[model samples]
Target: MTDEADPKGLIRESYRIEGISTGECRSIFVDWALSLGPAMTPPAAIALLIARYAAANPGHPMNAVLSDGLEAPPEARRRGGRAARVAG
Candidate 1:
């Protein structure tokens, strides 16, 4: 049976790949994230993923990507534009 954090096994298969790059792991992670059910939150899912795989596969690239997922997102900033130049 599949785990709720990885119902489709995308993360599991990603770890099995030989020489999987961080970029590739990132891609697989996106798919995995989108596939998560509404009941799951990203951080909780990522924590589960790490707990499930990290000890046995410490060097796996997916681990780094998963950790990155838990970090707070960067501040959103608007670049210069017509709106920025205009005053209300």
Candidate 2:
């Protein structure tokens, strides 16, 4: 699997990163999710990530943060550029 699709390294690295806050990790995770190829779904990816990291790194701050992110509803996309007029 591509590095982007797999959360193992990312999770571990996030912990090793000095001064990396949960909020920063959340943003990183979002970027990682958006970079995924078409074959993967965000929900499925999130579930897998939780299963792997949450179990192994249960005490890690990212576990709870990532779990909450998974539970939260996806944000609505803001229409802009050519779609701005149509959105209004």
Top candidate, metric TM-score: 1
Computed on alpha carbons, the lDDT of every model, listed in order, comes to 0.91, 0.70
> Could you give candidate 2's per-residue lDDT for residues 1-88 as a string of tens digits?
5554454466557766766777888877766766666776777776777876777665767777777867867889977788777745
Q: How far in Å is the alpha carbon of 43 misplaced in model 2?
A: 0.7
Shift in Å, residue 28, candidate 1: 0.2
**Residue pairs with clashing backbones, model 2:** none
Clashing pairs in 1: none
| Model 2: worst 10 consecutive residues (lDDT sum) | 1-10
> Relative to the unseen true structure, what is the C-alpha lDDT of residue 45 in candidate 1, on a scale of 0 to 100?
90
